[model samples]
Target: MIVETSPENFQVWVHSSRALSLEEKRMWLERMRSDPAAHPKNRWGRCPGFRNTKEKHRSPTGRFPLARLIWIDWDSQADIPLLVPESKPSLLSHPSRRGSVCHPADPCRYHFKKDNESTTDFAYALSLARRGFSDDQIRQRILSERTDWSNHKGEKESKTTSIAPSVVSNR
Candidate 1:
């Protein structure tokens, strides 16, 4: 599915019966020339009909662009490509294993030290903010992903608001 999330910005999604593994998803995203900062876990796209309020998208008519569904190829039956096995490296050949805290049992070994739940949530919220999501929408998404935030009343709202300026400045 291809959605026009702004005047010219688009997001594409591939629906498949078989779920792609993390590596496979990353490979597919790369193949598709997606945003480099986009993570495989951030699967949701901008909601259609919502106004894209980025100043750059604002028209001379004093209105923002609305996100809309551009196209959908429902009949396409494409599948993710299969990856060939590469020669394995010995455990000793791994660089991080030398002194890092990551262990075989640590599921987060694939991520960097800066990629904790809070940081991930913030990044997700920031992405939404950049895409012109309303504060309520961003807050709802952050709270849904990080249920622990519900205990901290208003934190999600504050964070979502904070990201709006950052998103503007970033451009």
Candidate 2:
């Protein structure tokens, strides 16, 4: 089973023991290409407010920089696995490690863990649109998703913390 999620909908496509025909593959690709979010131009659109000379040097790939993968057990008999598309020779190969399972309560339970250290390319782009940082500036401040920063004494913390409304009101 293969699952593809986008801003619009989440769909699961199942394959049996037989391999998909060339035409079938083409059809699936066509559907994906037709989606607005999946379109290469939309996926790589310029950030609203930032200017970065280095970002201009990036290759224009059709795939989004921050696209995430989630695994689910199609057979129900097997465990879900983590998938890294870049490391795989092809999409047909199965992942070696099983990823964290989807919790029953959360619909989107697969936590995305990026292999690289820098901020996700797409996320950096979004931050540029929202906060407007230069290429060098973005590069210097961006941290890996796994990075943990803390504050000592009365100094402000580097990380942004989300506070629930109820919790905030009680303070």
Each model's lDDT comes to 0.64, 0.34
Error of 1 at 164 (Å): 44
lDDT of 2 by residue, 118-154 (tens): 2233333333323334444433443333243342311
Which candidate has the highest TM-score of all? 1
Q: How accurate locally is residue 16 in candidate 2, as Cα lDDT from 0 to 100?
A: 41
Off by over 4 Å in 1: 74-76, 84-171
CA deviation > 4 Å runs, candidate 2: 1-15, 31-67, 74-171
Clashing pairs in 1: none
Superposed on all Cα atoms, the candidates' RMSDs to the truth, in angstroms, are 20.4, 21.9
